[model samples]
Target: MPTLYLLKTFSDSTFSLDVLIGEDDMTEHVDVVVAGGGPVGLMLAVELRLAGVAVTVLERRTDIDPTIKAGSLNSPTIQALYRRGMLPELEAARDENMRQFAAFAAQRSGGGGPAIPRFAGHFGGVMLDRDTIDQDDPVLVEQAHLGTLGLVSQQQFESMLERRARDLGVDVRRGVTLTGFHDTGDGVTVDTDSGTVTAGWLVGCDGGRSLVRKQAGFDFPGTAPEITAYQAMATLRGTEALEVGWHVTDTGVYAYGPHPGRILVAEFDGAPRDRTEPVTPAELQAAVRRVTGVDVGVDAITSATRFTDNARQATEYRKGRVLLAGDAAHVHSPFGGQGLNLGVGDAVNLGWKLAATVRGWAPDGLLDTYTAERHPVGEWVLDWTRAQIAIMRPDPHARAIRAVVADLASRGDGATYLATRISGVWQRYDLPGEHPLVGRSAPDLAFADGSRLADHLHDGRALLVDLRDDAGLRRSADGYADRLTVLTATADDTDLRALLVRPDGYVAWAATDAADTGPDKYLGLWLGAPVGD
Candidate 1:
């Protein structure tokens, strides 16, 4: 029998309990143990708890770090949050941030001038023209009300997620770090610094340097880093040395910012020798001068960090009882602001499916669909970042291609393409369906009561939209009531007779006429056989 250790701290004292592995009576159990209580982990925890699954999140940090990471939310991410009843809060937060930014910009411009343009988004350093996007496109039209872009700090976003997780009664344990874990053929015995937890599933949302991914032996393969980038908040002696906004210079690419002291510089001088080393003022000044070809002196610094274009992704998101999400599963350049949105998407997609599996009602191969649906998205993000890096290279060929891309980006179709990818609205899983909207994110269909389809999904259940209020369709869906919600609402689009939407807000089945395919097969395929079957 193996001896497992559990540590407990009482005030100033620490103690341990050594129990034999077979002694199940002494062990703590949970449905899932999520390592790393970042936004992704907390989001997953909330999703699990919403479905009544017992979840325990282990976070190394005692508190949320107020770091400026991802600064915007894409369209699909916005839609996902909206489905969870977070749209109002999201808008409030974005508005507050925008106000602060506006004040800052005003003060910088002497408090009296034409207002700066609101940021749409960017691909590489090329600015996307929002005015040029094709709003008539179905994809863009669906996302219009949701707003294709939302500006919010990652710290604020994580805080919101943490609050939601706690509200959902998720057992979030702070100051606990997952050191290692082993699959015991049934459940995962998670070893954290604080104690041991026996959970049916273990998920790693532990960022790029993930111990779970390495220890669980998940194969992560992709391109290596080519450039070392630095984002810092520091006082500069010569403020006029660099201009605000992104600049692709002969040496490398650099971006001064909307914020007074914020600066970001990227050099194609290979990866940093030691990314772990603390960035010093002297180092930052040198990099700034190198990239901008100007003598700028970094006097004082508040915070600084190094990043690379080192893109890598786990071929599989799961191995037995262990799984990975967010940066743990895939990492790439942060140029397009895709990381957070992608991770949030992963959490939403995996959440209900995992919850169903835990509750013992999931259809065959339900959990397997998580990777099948998400891995392609991750692959595309990796390639997307790589493409940006190609355009950012300082060589002559790269500059020529950059010009061409910039020109294309100025056009309606090109801008729409870029916006669609950046906003993540273009994401559509290849599900078994002929309808164009089948695998796409469901539109926010309106009802007679004025409540949108998103309002019906707040409880975290698959939805059966009965457009005709068909008594027969309602009767047919009665058997699967436990796993889904059947809403008898009038559709705004006359062509959409009825549709079955998954818990993640993707259309699973649709019908344009009475003769069209019914929801029975898709419901069975997704929600499993109805009760008493």
Candidate 2:
């Protein structure tokens, strides 16, 4: 057996941890250790700190990347950040004219009949122009701004998050990578580039190629796509029309819009290139000209990358003491820009749960629910992206089918359904039965105390909104006072009287009528017990 060693820190803050290691041959133990320091990892660290959990983040990169890979933030993700008081900074950086365009696509059917063009009406998608909009939106906006999504370069966003995590007292270490890990019964022994650290739980928030996931012996199951996408940012000269045109042709699909210095243009359905081959500026310029029907001069090339629309998800998100989030858990095509948003949501969901478990305020089963809940969501995302990718195929029959679907989508019901799905406004949990509170995100309602439902969740505590006549519910929860908040309101309050909220802002229990049940029975279940008969 390896010898055990303990590294003690002087700090006694709730977010601080004592590191354990195998000295020379010593083995040690700790509560939780996270791998990767990207946005997902940093967000998880900040969130854990906020929840009073001790966490350490290990990052391989010495510095943050300056390129803006993922640009759009979705509505649900914005709401999640708002609940934590982190949305304003992001909203302030949004573009003013960055709005979604709704349109219908019509294509003639290949059959030897009259042009059977199908029309799909407006589907909501955002035009993310970050640099131009950063000034007006600033990083701090009001709660009302939470209703919309914002845009920021990946590098800039990560920088801000790093600062925030440090400010929140999260122990972030760079130039450290997870080499391997061993799951001991009591905790996990993690081997890093610097040294070994032990923790009660290990979370993998690393990217698609996660060492932690691999080390944990988890399997990622999914299909790889045939066509690959090539993307690059460049300073190119384009006519006013060409600069604004979102073009598609027989060769490939291309889009051009104003970026910081030049036009940001991208091409999908391009042939794959080997990683060893250098993608030159001339090659990208030629491809752009071929697809756009415009000869644009490439002044400078910023960055270029190639990725396939492979849709795959981990078979499981959790393996014993090790959990996965972000790209570590799932990876799909970037068609909907859902990658980063989904990962951030995972961080938000798991962060509080991990914190609660570490603090002993939550049962172990609550930790298990993270994978059960998020894995299905990942599967759904992969399916959605696959459907989008299939439509992009250039085959005549596929185009004919797409035209019909587009036409149907243009109609009232089809349009509404497509719009809601694309806008990501229609996602709901699959609750077991028809309970009013089931499957719905807890709404941010106004309270008599001048606080909103989101205000209670901001501190990472489950809130029991009491509408009944009893004031005794508050007295009963006195023992769990620090972990629970009881809000009393009359039926006239309408909004606040209708729902009980979980820390993640989900409806734990709700009633259409204010007098449905006293706070005692509801509180018991919301606090992890079934209501007594």
Best by lDDT: 1
Best of the candidates, TM-score: 1
For model 1, residues 212-277, the per-residue Cα lDDT tens digits are: 999999999999899999988888767565665677999999977666678889999888899888
Model 2 whole-model lDDT (C-alpha atoms): 0.65
What would the TM-scores of all predictions be?
0.93, 0.82
Report the C-alpha lDDT of model 2 over 388-499, residue by residue, as the tens digit: 6666566776567666766755454555455445445455665433355565666666656666667667777777776664455456555556567777765343544445
Ten contiguous residues minimizing lDDT sum, candidate 2: 100-109
List of clashing residue pairs for candidate 1? none
Runs of candidate 2 exceeding 4 Å displacement: 1-7, 13-16, 19-30, 95-147, 239-245, 258-271, 275-279, 408-412, 432-434, 448-450, 467-469, 489-498, 514-533
Q: Candidate 1: which stretches are off by over 4 Å?
A: 1-26, 111-115
